[model samples]
Target: MLKILATADIHSPRFLDLFIKSLNKVKIRPDLIILAGDLVDKNNIYALKHVYEILINKYEEIPIISVFGNEEYRGFENKYREMYPVFKWLDDEYIILEMKELKIGIIGTRGALDKPTPWQSRHMPWLYNYYRELPLKISAMIDEARSKGAKYIFLVSHYGVTYKNLEGEPRNIWPYLASSRMEKIIKDKKIDLVIHGHTHNGVRDKINIDGVEVYNVSLPARREVVLIDFTPKSKVFGLEKWLYSGG
Candidate 1:
């Protein structure tokens, strides 16, 4: 079985000490950790690095996967990435982790988020360029992962993929929160699970796209790191309730 711990919109390192302790309390040592985005507060590049270092020190053997949030790109995306060489920065790309008996493929990107309908306003063109062209690029990455013989696929992004997970946010900004294009990709990608952050005000929303499960793991949404399990032969993948809510 493969165990994964996922969180998002963790804007600071204040909760990490407790977070690490909680993991120990649960007796779950995750093989993989996924951080969706907003890892730092504002433009404080140092904060992201400092928190990441703590994670590296604590889980030295674990593989950490991450993507950049809109805030991370405020100025530190490039610089912050260069500072952390121990982690996997999988923005707009794919990686295959070959487990003993199964292979897990992950395709990640910040994701495009243009409005789906004409009623919604167009916005965030500054970040929208990626929100514009990333879908097609991400599709290729997904295809590439399948070609590499991945048994399961995880689609990680810093933006929401569907409107279902973006509920509770202002209706006016729906277009800026996630892209319809990404949802279109979900239909074809056959993703086993979709994980993303950015919707802090939203619930721990779970939506089904075709057959794939999409989860919004924003810090506020989950209130803790969520542990997910996957059986190699049975191919069962889902949240396993091995965590606590952050205070």
Candidate 2:
């Protein structure tokens, strides 16, 4: 079985202490760590060092993969990559990892919003078209992973992919928070699992999209790290209840 720990929206230094405390209580040593994004606050790139220190000190060289969040800022993507080569950062990219002879394909992205924010629409006019095309681009990536013999496929994004988890947030603003387009890809591809964050006020952290498990691992919403255990046979043991038990 492959054990994974996932979380996002650390906004580093702000929630760094709480995150440290939370990690200290985890009894399971995950095979993989997924940071959905927003590692630092408002492009405070340097703060990621503190987050890196905390995780590295505890997990050592355990593979940690991440994606860019909105606060990560598009222009600084390469800078973050150069600064931290240890963490594999994926922005609308895919990487295949072999663990226990199981090939796990992780597709990471900042994700798309059905409706771009006012600031984005005004400043980044191309964003509207980009968001519209993201679903198809991601779908192609899934096919690539499958062709490469990936037994399990994971979609990791910075933005919430579905509105089901955005229960507490204002219903009318759901389009601005995530894209239903992504949801269609998940269903069509039958992705093994989906992990994302950015919705801090969401009430449901876990939901099922056509039997595929989707988790909103925002640190603020769940107030804890999310744990998942998966096997090569496509059996997933969700640890939502287990996490609350002194994790």
Candidate 3:
């Protein structure tokens, strides 16, 4: 089974340091590392690159997949890309990761907010096209990934794809947190595992839309690096005891 370490909304390099230290203490090395976005507090290329270097240094040879969050897009995305040209930046991307025994397809995007929630503030007219079109584009990406014959499909984004993962966030900010259109696509696509951050709510909530599991892996939310095993017929018996919140 390939072990994956997933984290999101790191916001600072300090969290990465602590996370690495904690991993060392436990003697756990992951086969893959996925960052769900918000690598820095501010959208500075230097700041984001600094954090990226720290991550690469700690987890050498492990494939890392990352996306830009709302914070990263606050400035010019091109500037950020120019700094780290070699990294797997998966904002609007479909890629395949081939392991010795596992083939996984990753579909990623920095999801846009659709003003479906009642409390959302109005966005500018120029940005209207994005709010309307991003969901469809992202959904198409997921379909393309699945068509490529991946044993496991991981759909990742910066915005919450379902309201189930945004429990702790205020209702007023719900519109800013995720899109109902994305949620519908996720359920329709029947992806294996959907991951996202942005909302700092914990892993205490999950959106099981038609048995598709969606998790929020934000650092402030999960408070710990998430560990997942993709070996067939495997289970972490003792650990899954009480993580579920509802009956």
- Candidate 1, residues 42-136, lDDT tens digits: the string is 65677776677667887888999998876676445567778887778876788999765668888877666774333223543355455567888
Provide the TM-score for each candidate, comma-separated. Answer: 0.84, 0.95, 0.82
Each model's C-alpha lDDT?
Answer: 0.74, 0.89, 0.70
User: Could you say which candidate leads in lDDT?
Assistant: 2
Off by over 4 Å in 2: 234-241
Best by TM-score: 2
Candidate 3: global Cα-lDDT? Answer: 0.70
For candidate 2, what is the lDDT? 0.89
lDDT of 3 at 232: 42
Clash count (model 3, backbone only): 0
In model 2, which residue pairs have backbone atoms overlapping below 3 Å?
none
State how far residue 21 of model 2 sits from its true place (Å): 1.2
Q: How many clashes in each structure?
A: 3, 0, 0
RMSD of each: 3.8, 1.7, 4.9
Please provide, for model 3 over 67-174, each residue's C-alpha lDDT reduced to its tens digit, 9 standing for 90 to 100. 888768644767767887656888688799898666688987887776633323344454557777987887787677767877667888988886666778887778
Question: What does candidate 1 score on TM?
Answer: 0.84
Residue pairs with clashing backbones, model 1: 112-131, 113-178, 113-179
